[model samples]
Target: MPHVTFIEHNGTAHTVEAVIGKSLMEAAVDNSVPGIDADCGGACACATCHVFVAPEWEAKTGTRNEAEVAMLNFAAEVKPNSRLSCQIEITAAHDGLVVHMPDGQH
Candidate 1:
């Protein structure tokens, strides 16, 4: 399992062990990390799972696919590092990954 840290908009951090091959959205939801609603159930159809990938982890997390890019347009406070968590599958390289939530999910 990879350990991921999810930081809330208010600066709280929740570190959780994430299963390999699962999506980050699933990990957050399973661990009860705040701010990741995953409204589309990891289908990449919604932006409720939006997160800002830390600069250091960006390369490892990879670029967003077209569907995720499209969905993020509906998110609030979108930034260059923004990603739909459902699109980021957990991998061994993702250990210690950190993501920040926006003030709110749109």
Candidate 2:
């Protein structure tokens, strides 16, 4: 399992052991981490799973796909590193990955 840390807008951090092959959104929900609503159930159809990939982890996390890019268009407080958590699958290489939630989500 990879250890992923989720940071909230208020500066709180939730570090959880994430399972391989599962989406980051699922890990957050399973671990009861705050800030990731995942309203679309990892379908990539909604922006409730929005997160900002820490700059250092951006390359490892990779770029957003078309669907994610489209969905993020409707998200709030979007940034260059913004990504839909549901689109981010967990892997060993992602250990110690850190993601931050926006101040608000639409």
Candidate 3:
């Protein structure tokens, strides 16, 4: 399992043990991390799972897919590191991964 830290817009941090092969959104939802609504249930159909990938972990998280790119258009405060957590599968390499949530979901 990988341990990921989700930092809220206000600086609160929730660190959860994420199961490999599961999506980041699932990890957040499973641990009840605030700010990650995961409204589409990891279907890549909504931006409620939006997160900002830590710069050092960006390469490990990989590039967003076309569907994720499209869905993120609906997210608030999109930035260079913005990503739909549902699109990122967990792996051992992602241990210590840290992500930030926006002030609110769109």
Q: Candidate 2 — which residues are off by over 4 angstroms?
A: none
Q: Which residue runs of candidate 3 sit more than 4 Å off their true CA positions?
A: none
Residues 13-101, candidate 3: write the lDDT tens digits.
99999999999999999999989998879888879999999999999999989998888877768898999998999999999999999
What TM-score, over all chains together, does every model reach? Answer: 0.98, 0.97, 0.97
What is candidate 1's CA lDDT for residue 68? 84
Q: What would the TM-score be for candidate 3 when compared with the true structure?
A: 0.97
Worst 10 residues of 1 by lDDT: 67-76
lDDT, residue 78, candidate 2: 85
Question: For candidate 2, which ten residues in a row score worst on lDDT?
Answer: 33-42
Which is the leading candidate under TM-score?
1
- Measured with C-alpha atoms, the lDDT of residue 33 in candidate 3 is 92
* Clash count of each predicted structure: 0, 0, 0
Cα RMSD of all models vs. native, in order, equals 0.6, 0.7, 0.7
